[model samples]
Target: MQVAVINRSHHPLPAYQTEHAAGLDVRANLDAAVTLAPLERALIPTGLYLEIPPGYEAQVRPRSGLAYKHGIGIVNSPGTIDADYRGEVKVLLVNLSNEPFVVQDGERIAQLVFARHETVQWQQVAELSETGRGAGGYGSTGTR
Candidate 1:
């Protein structure tokens, strides 16, 4: 719940926009604007260092508004920040549109969501259990 964090940027700490919001809006920390041409991808810094608890991770996701308005999307959607990671949080963003996209300092670029995950140990089984649609994938199930 209470994860330790260090803020190195001038922007305020990341926070949820609303009461029921699942992710906190994280801002871009840059000295100057960074522009991404069409199909260009860049790693944008957040200047945030986090100390997440064991069995938990921080997920960095794209903002819908930025994706819809400026055709900006995270190259690695929902990037995972492991509990032991102590480096700055960086977002991999790509310009999806024909026009260039500008990333400004203090602009909310990504959403950070803390999640609890389970550690799995391999059972080393030769076969997996069968299911109703075993081995069916890539739209093998109809869209209705």
Candidate 2:
């Protein structure tokens, strides 16, 4: 599961904080601090270019600590980086709190999770089989 990457920022490459961590922390590659007013969003660059393998994708996600502490999150949660994409990784960050938040250079702003995906082929069919909970969706089951 090796990926080809080019890092132009002064920050080190993204890495998992824990041994069993699923995602690697990605940093912001800014020369100076950028302030985000409440309810504002910005496109922050990572200065990382990756070459993901076919059938795989890089998922950019928000950090739980930042979300809980500062109400900072990704505008498009789990933003997908397609395998064919070869551009610098950028994160769409949003401030959900009522106060401003500052993003510093080389700050851990997001996480990247590499996952394998499948391509689907549509099959024309007349009818489909029935199940116990047929077509149940969107809170069909109780939270409990």
Candidate 3:
């Protein structure tokens, strides 16, 4: 699947780190470092503009290493970039730890995963079909 993209950042285009990697690492495009205090969030730009296919979407997700090491994560996990969007790709980053997190220019902050999605049509049914565990949710099953 080929996607049309425009790169205006100093760093190279986002790419898969491994052969079997599902998401591509996206970098932060900034003139100077941006510090995020604990529990603070900021919208960091990537300087990337993409043209996704009609049946697909670009999912912006947090990097596991950053989350585990620095308590850095995306405010809106797995943010959806619609196919019709034609603006710069920005990430909503948040600091979950007590210390402030500094985001440097060209730093890998998020991962982009392109996924296929389906548009569903409402059937306007009278009732939904019954299941084995109907209406049972929120820890209905035991942890053990």
Instruction: Report the lDDT tens digits of candidate 3 across residue range 18-108.
Output: 9999999999999999999999999999999999999999999999999999999999899999999999999999999999999999999
lDDT for residue 118 in candidate 1, whole number 0-100: 100
Best TM-score among the predictions, by candidate number:
3
List ranges where model 1 is wrong by over 4 Å. none
Error of 3 at 34 (Å): 0.2
Error of 1 at 86 (Å): 0.1
Model 2 lDDT tens row, 39-124: 99999999999999999999999999999999999999999999999989999999999999999999999999999999999999
In lDDT terms, how accurate is model 2?
0.96
Give candidate 3's error at residue 5 in angstroms: 0.3
Against the hidden reference, what TM-scores do the models get? 0.96, 0.95, 0.97
RMSD of each: 1.3, 1.5, 1.3
* Residue 44, model 2: Cα distance from true site in angstroms: 0.2
Against the true structure, candidate 1 has what lDDT?
0.95
Flag regions of model 2 displaced more than 4 Å: none
Residue 41: error of model 1 in Å? Answer: 0.8
